[model samples]
Target: MTLIAERVRELTGARQPFVHATVVRAQAPTSAMPGDDAVILADGSIEGFVGGVCAETSVRAAALDTLRDGNTMLLRVLPDGAASFPDAPGAQVVVNPCLSGGAIEIFLRPMLPRPLIGVAGATTPIGAAVVTLAGFLDLEITEPMAYAGASAVVVAGLGRDDEQVIRAALDAGVPLISLVASRTRGAAVLDSLGLTAEERARVRPHAGIDIGARTHQEIALSVLAEIVRELRASSPEPVAAAPTRTAIDPICGMTVVIGEGTPHAVVDGVEHWFCCAGCRDRFVAAS
Candidate 1:
């Protein structure tokens, strides 16, 4: 377990957090055989063996907490209903990792979120892929004028049919692209489109999966898996993410958060925040 902590520190980028679970005590007559230990990887895989099914489930949930809080906790579970925890922000969900005959206490901790996946090709399914994998939205490539949001661009078969897809995404400095095809086929497609060798080099071809992934569903799964792996490998620390709320300027329809030192107007019952001076002026006038 200590080695796992060192491993997290050693990796410059780790997307998922690692958690250590050590079973402290097991009852002699009961199901839990003492001294069991486990390590929960970023991808929700356990390395060591615990006691029974109940113990495993309880510990798995606790490990996820490590990812969110980036802290370590000692979880002590008694022979059912014997243990209880005090209320704290995101810290009350501990359960005794011991089941049956004895009680067990374990430590759980998480590392960081080092996952960023770049997806390309058509990009319509990219959104669905994002939902499926809990991944960072790298980019989406599609025909010209199509817009939503993407960390990078995902492209379809290359041609004049979709020149803007490449041009705009590139101009925006999207670092990764996941194209679907063989290397030769991809090169031919780019050549036909008059893409310079430099331009072509900027585009990543033949996404994370191999060429043989024939079905759309299978391809999506494969690509998603690759993205998750990449994110895990790239991130040095995986931290739990929390929702952020921006103060909305009632007078101007602008949103701002605390860190953003934007001009604000107190609108009687509400305090409004703005992105710039002009918006603040307009807001004051409207009010």
Candidate 2:
């Protein structure tokens, strides 16, 4: 258990998504005892043992589901004949015939990485202020070149080399690019870069929420606020209803457009869709 805990900490530090499955309860004939734990990696590999093969299978399936949707779940694995036992509210129930009449309840918790913001061109006071404000806002910050993995990049170069910094950030494929500069200067920089209209549109000039900021700190706060808004907009919202034109893949949690050739399955009277045939096969096998 201590080793598993240490591994979990290591994985968390690496910003890798994983599921920690802990056996909260166990009935007689179960191979595992309460308090046993396992770490399920994003690739569906199990590093520790929570139960025997049957129970572990269910745990892996539930852990994958939790990792895909970023949801914590209480998974109850019972023998096929034990279906009469009432499952706890909000618990995911899996009936496995190979459980040998034993039952196990495991809690699956998904650990996802925090959103990262790259602060580039920090040589200027404005850039430094943005970094400081980002820290205060509990946002993780990285160098400009390291922004490739970041959720967004804020370029605060308010000098001659501002265009260079912005170009580097854009080439890194950073989703959101916020440039701190006057409208005239930003337009001049964009024109000089010879970027396409679409690429130019990606740059947010004056890079902040419209709070009429004047000082560096205020500007930094506004920029952080805008970043927060972008993050919120990118996050997956609850689906009020399953659209006929699109469906979420159960295996990988990817939103798939439903079309003539799209992969799909009907499991237990519920329609499940997949982005690819591989995901569809995996979902069928798991089910």
Clashes of each: 28, 0
Q: List the residue pairs that clash in candidate 2.
A: none
Write model 2 residue lDDT over 45-100, tens digit each, in one string: 68888987546656766777777678799998888777434558998887765466
* TM-score result, candidate 1: 0.34
The TM-scores, one per candidate, come to 0.34, 0.73
Q: For residues 176-271, could you state the per-residue lDDT of candidate 1 as single tens digits?
A: 445555678666655666766667765656555664666665566566555555545655334543333455545433333323334667777777
Q: Given candidate 2, what's the lDDT at residue 62?
A: 71
- Which candidate's lDDT is highest? 2
Best by TM-score: 2
Root-mean-square deviation of Cα positions for candidate 2 versus the true structure, in angstroms: 8.8
Q: Over the full model, what C-alpha lDDT does candidate 2 score relative to the true structure?
A: 0.77
- Residue 175's lDDT in candidate 2: 72
Off by over 4 Å in 1: 1-149, 157-162, 191-202, 236-287
